[model samples]
Target: MTAIDWADYATGDKNAASRTLLMREFLRRAALWVDHLGGSERWPFFDIAERVDSSVRADPDLLERLDEFTNANVPEFIARRMCRAAVHWAELRESTEVTLPDLPDPYEPLIVLYERGGVFFVENGVADFEMRRVPLRTWQANLAPEPVVEIDQAVLDAANEEVH
Candidate 1:
């Protein structure tokens, strides 16, 4: 799929633009996770959890951005799991040597992102729903053309209102 020019909406509809930017960030991270795991294959949430943990260690502020993405209430289960995994992993990392944290309950189902004929689709762990597809030129296209700024909650709220 062609990359969205989020900047075009900047002046006309700031809220929508911000929301799209957020989704772009979420998808970008998902694509990276898939690449890190060595091609698109069904992956348990735990694997993603470990990656999330390491990512947080490298960039402390990533947790906050993940939190913001989760709070935006995206409909995809994978999105929620990604944020939840990050939180779970971070708590585990905080455990002291004397008192190790208990293992978190396992995440149900499995998610995967695969490519065919140069297009990508996400196999959302649910059987009832069909796989979700997003066409793009390449994995690198998932990255935003420019830096994505932090979106204000009020802007999200306004965008949600417009949608309703």
Candidate 2:
């Protein structure tokens, strides 16, 4: 006979546990937003999204399980509440302009952020990310000559090359 295991209940078994998990995820995304980016002067929201995306890319299953988890555990009220809260926290949540940083314009979702950098990116609907050519400054020393840290425009031109 198989041994009994009540770990599911203790760990997370019922509707309550599911809602908690969903809310947590929603909250996490909310926190990434500029509006919810903590009630103070914060850096661009998209900048934070970039880091978040890179980290999340590791566990790709999270997105796949999201629907099953949400529908089974998360109620319409929870989803609505979260969406409403997100909108209330930041108008962009409601507006179509919401996006992540590095993507100057509003975008569909983070999936796009991973794709063509041209696509606009969204993060909790508060901020937007746009693609821009930034100089890859050298971390050589505290103070170096101008050429040592010169702004190279060729980087943008080479983005399409994808090879040396």
Measured by TM-score, the strongest candidate is 1
Q: Residue-wise lDDT of candidate 2 within 33-145, one digit each (tens)? A: 43333432332223333332323221235334544444454333333223222223333333344453432212222222212221122244322222221221111211221
Best by lDDT: 1
Q: Give the TM-score of candidate 1.
A: 0.33
The residue-level lDDT of candidate 2 at 84 comes to 26
Where model 2 places Cα greater than 4 Å from the true spot, the runs are 1-13, 34-99, 102-164
Compute the lDDT of residue 77 as modeled in candidate 2.
Answer: 34
Q: Cα deviation in Å at residue 44, candidate 2?
A: 19
The lDDT for every candidate, in the order shown, is 0.38, 0.28
lDDT of 2: 0.28
Regions of candidate 1 where Cα sits further than 4 Å from its true position: 1-14, 42-47, 50-80, 92-146, 150-164
